[model samples]
Target: MLRELEKAEQKWGGANKAIDQWLNNRRNLLVHYCRIAGLPPYENGNSLPSVDNVRSFCEMLVDYVSEGHFEVYNQVVSACEKHGQTSKAVAQQLLPKINDTTDAALDFNDKYTEAADDKVLMQLDSDLSRLGDAMETRFQLEDQLLEVLHTRHS
Candidate 1:
């Protein structure tokens, strides 16, 4: 996920102000995810992620998704309107799938925000895995939107 994000930045980092900010948000959210999931350099799985870490991840997760819906999607749609039908069609197709991912993210946030018991902690790894998959899908959809828009708008 992190590697994909870096590649995305390389490809579309400065294409526009909104995309630049959205991708930066993605970077921060993925870093927080890595820390909580104990992936890579954060892999100190001798213990569960600290409560503070989980809380922070949930906060970042919500904020990231909020920006996508409230800011990025609108910007993408507006850009597409100034272009061709293909871009408009692409945006229409992709945005709904992205919304599904948002639901998954919000579900994860709600589940873990107040989690403090062994039972809840026991689900963290699996939940993270599911959320990771959803996020990967969402990122691909978002990039497709950006690619289509940038091709025409740029």
Candidate 2:
């Protein structure tokens, strides 16, 4: 898992700098998420995540999603439009899938908005698992958008 994440962090760069920066934010968010979920290095013995870790992840998660939806998506669409009609058509076709993932991400964020104590974190195990699945889907969709709309056009 860690290896895959590291690979993704490095793979989606050099084409569009703005998209690279946005992908870096995604990488950082995943690192924080791995820590909170006690994956690999974070899983040694009783190295459960502290409340601070969870809180930080939640904060970063919101910021990342917001930027993706409001800034990065718009930039991608604009770039695709500038590229040509075919690029714009491809972006339009993929947008609804991307929007669905955004809605899922927002719902996940809402579940953790009031996460104030350890109990809440404990209860979040299932939600986090579901979030992992959602994030995987979102990442794949976003990568497709980057490839079709940004990298190819660039």
Report the number of the highest-TM-score candidate: 1
RMSD per model, one decimal: 1.1, 2.3
Name the TM-score of candidate 1. 0.95
Q: Determine which window of 10 residues in candidate 1 has minimal summed lDDT.
A: 114-123
Per-residue alpha-carbon lDDT of model 1 for 6-59, expressed as tens digits?
888998888878889889989999988988888888897578887778889999
Candidate 2: C-alpha RMSD after superposition: 2.3
In model 2, pairs of residues that clash are none
lDDT of 2: 0.76
User: What is the per-residue lDDT of model 2 for residues 1-154, given as tens digits with 9 covering 90 to 100?
Assistant: 4455566556656656777788788888888887778786667455556777677787888888888888988999898898888888888888888777777667767767766777776666677888888778877777777778645664
What's the TM for model 2?
A: 0.85
lDDT of each: 0.88, 0.76
Best candidate (score: lDDT): 1
Instruction: State TM-scores per candidate.
Output: 0.95, 0.85
